[model samples]
Target chain A: MPMNPSLLDNPKSDRIRRVADLANAKARRRSGRVLVEGPQSVREAVAHVPDAVSDLYVLSESEGADTEERSPTLAAIVDRAEQCDSIYIHRASEAVMHRISPNAQGIAAVVDMGALTSEESQVAWSDTPTIAAFWQVRDPGNAGAVIRAADAAGCDAVIFVDDCVDRFNPKVVRSTAGSLFHIPVLTMGADEMLAWCSAHGIAVVAADIYGTPGNAPRTLPDMLADRVAVGQSKAVLFGNEARGLPRQLLERVDRIVTIPIYGKAESLNLATSAAVMLFSLAMSSHMGRM
Target chain B: MPMNPSLLDNPKSDRIRRVADLANAKARRRSGRVLVEGPQSVREAVAHVPDAVSDLYVLSESEGADTEERSPTLAAIVDRAEQCDSIYIHRASEAVMHRISPNAQGIAAVVDMGALTSEESQVAWSDTPTIAAFWQVRDPGNAGAVIRAADAAGCDAVIFVDDCVDRFNPKVVRSTAGSLFHIPVLTMGADEMLAWCSAHGIAVVAADIYGTPGNAPRTLPDMLADRVAVGQSKAVLFGNEARGLPRQLLERVDRIVTIPIYGKAESLNLATSAAVMLFSLAMSSHMGRM
Candidate 1:
């Protein structure tokens, strides 16, 4: 890929405006493009899915100084993007870069939304794989954090069930801290997700502080102690930020497990709960193998 | 105590301005008070340390309506404050409440700063205590989230070692989700923190991905399997958001433990790392006892 000779100095240009508009859901859907802001996210997009990245915009040397004083961190990302034949590298003025995305440290990327979406068939589940699923996770930051947590736990894939934040939202991409490209994230309806898990021979475990009246919640440690179950393939499902899993959903899952709060904290937030639950299961499963 | 008869309709009143200014560190020091925003935090403050809460501000039920229609959640919190003789309940218009604190969900509180500080001597350490300490944690939200995590793990006390965000910051208090009232949070210099933990016969474990050269970090699961050692009293210290613990600090700690990342997510954020580390240790210790 060759770098564009012309410097993009106009922040109001239609090209730049369209790229900035990708931050909006309507713009993303209309253009079939998603903005990946910041060096971390852009770097990951280029490294893991270079074909998906259409353009890379980075802050250029001020006006016309002979010396290139770009920070090494961002320069490395741009260098990596340059290696991809499909990526078009463009230099933009600081103002233009800011207009593109204020959160972008020095670089941003425009990725194809179609290429980013992972079909259910694309997910290659490992033997005894663990999956992380969220139901109606409204907060963009929470959605991103859980994705990163799932990735760190080595989950086979992430499923955003029912009405949830769009995975391509710029804020969600920024919050994932580059983990978005490391794993497959799929969207599915509640019934479809449960049915898919059942068909894949994966047990559905609902993470809720309170289980249905008759089916009392099991403590995380109690579940962990049951090594046979903990080591099996399962999908740990989390609920919305304000309201936890509904009774109907709770009753349908194979098990309801809660992270025991030793102190007086009423409950854990969705992101924290997801990390604890996923990591605990991952560590226990790996340890069981050892 | 009865509710104040006159509804505070003035958002610009000196009283309201002073309370709102408590969001600033200098203002908090000058007024010798801290602002506890949101119904959850205010309720916890009233229930746990009523004597410290001097005033409670709640949204009024409109100008002159015969039927009071305040939210039940807010009304319940107000009722709890009413039982405390020292807490003065005052009704304010929505504008006044917004001016006091936009994040306050229909209620906020003014509490004495002196009462919130936990002297090292005041912390009631358990036989096998686990302390969560952070060094140079700059973000208010991360500071608050970690405190909540520490509380959920039933930590004996929280220590802010060296430079860190003020625990009294309104953003930090809001992020805690009321855990601030449930746990004792004490600030100390790095050296003082280490010395205090040593004096209390607690092991100093630094949570760092990279330990000092030749002193590789132990994985959390590996440490957990050592039931006897994990069951003993310890202080798990975390580092700044951007930087992990300094080599000098990492070298000084009795053990350097890192949470294993099974996938390509790179590293977990400070808040997530703290929750997983604290909760894992807490669970392991409890399971050991069982």
Candidate 2:
């Protein structure tokens, strides 16, 4: 049976009207809280049993609209959480959601974002710790999708450095489709990111679409060709679509690389570029043959 | 100097309204018509031309009262396009553009999409031309983005087969960021696709997230390695994310493949998955060593 709906819709139910802001998302970082947005993601978060989802936001008015798509089933999923705590905001008007979110497909939630803090935070990283670093990438959707690709590539983490989009932004949240809850996202300025790379002994490669940024080898494949510093962490940095990386930032890294584009299409989308690089790393790791 | 403001204020401009549908997009497609949307894209589209834009939309009664972001510069852009025989849609009633497009981002235009579609077709009839085939992709955005990836990967053409999304869909057109105009997108049925593959002597490699439909090879790299028929054309078929390809369809293909995924995360986003395989093929082609 589903959780009691009327209980959540009562006038006393104050939990439903809370605004989610950057402060809320940042608070999650401190208290191990991670915000999960929308209905499908809320359920997935519950299933993953991430650090106890703190709340569920459902439309009190739409609660009466009966369908498996909305209420009771969602309520049941919330009930199945580590705690039976789920609440519906009686005032969740579509306009309210639209105003508050880039696009609130419907529901949103707060869960434990999970235990990844830095690149080295994982003691036992994947055999192929494929890392995608956004260096000055400004698009929120592209940032979110890169995190999703990192998850798909089975990468240990997706990190951001100097001038990249905010990983916690709501638009990025919507684009990730819950991958944000699944992957480790790290952020820092160039000095700090470079410091981590040096200490960890990871091979840092720069991915520039314009091709002038030179690294240890010729091109992307040459870097992928026997570039794995096995038993050491590996990170590849992708930068601004038009300008790529700042010269100082590119120089601090181990190697510079680029995907060979064959047409006059100008440049590939950032997310598409991330997918290609992450997948290439995955293949190299899987084959284990440099 | 910018064109006259009164000319842009006139909504009766006939050439201003031609970009509202596929018939018009196709008309533009035939007569070197190009469509540009949003303030940024429009600005770039106009700056690139003495060639001439087709039409322009400027919301003189701009919403969101931002004086800096959307302003007289937009009016100036419209004025310039108008001088080039481009028509103008003025003070677009909130209802008109909203109905025509919910995502206008305040301005739009019909510009020449780009050069070359008018010159000659890119259809390849040789024995070993490379190609991409989308079996049942349902997202127009993903479909269009895959076309963009194919353009980057140097595939001769992208074929759509069985239950594909509408390629001409606006979301797809926008997602490709005009790369759709660069690639030849052909739609065909299941039988026709298989026949085309066979006739071209293309080794049709099917891609599924879980496993290849029946048993051709375990992963894409393996499939590429095992094709036996070297120097033959290759058509990579990607199936629906949900159900994948039916057994009968898989059996008709020369090979089946999976992307090597590491995370517990079940699958890659459809377009991301497609990009991985496509770039990997291009790598093989460039290296002259699969």
> Which candidate leads the pack in lDDT?
1
DockQ of each model vs. true complex: 0.64, 0.46
List TM-scores for all candidates, in order.
0.98, 0.76
Global lDDT scores for all candidate models: 0.90, 0.64
User: CA shift at B149, candidate 1, in angstroms?
Assistant: 0.2
Write out fnat for all predictions, comma-separated: 0.64, 0.58
Per residue, candidate 1 scores C-alpha lDDT tens digits across B1-290 of 77886889999999999999999999999989999999888888888889999999988867653356888888888888888899898989999999999999899999999999888877787889999999999999999999999999999999999999999999999899888888899999989998998998999999998888867889999998887768889999999999878888887899889999998898999999999999988988887721
Model 1 DockQ class: medium
- How does chain B score by TM in each prediction? 0.97, 0.69
Tens digits of per-residue lDDT, candidate 2, A1-290, equal 23344424332223332344522556545656445566656666666544455555554445453442446755565456525444332235555444334344556665544443434464346644557788887887787788888787777777788877667666676677667667777888888877876776667877775434344434556555554442346788888765777777766777666787875356777788888877776776666532
Model 1 RMSD in angstroms: 1.4
Question: Taking the tens digit of each residue's C-alpha lDDT, what string does model 2 give over B46-157?
Answer: 5554354555666646343234244675766665665554444444544555544567667776655453232215584433567888888887678878888887787888
Chain A TM-scores for all candidates read 0.97, 0.76
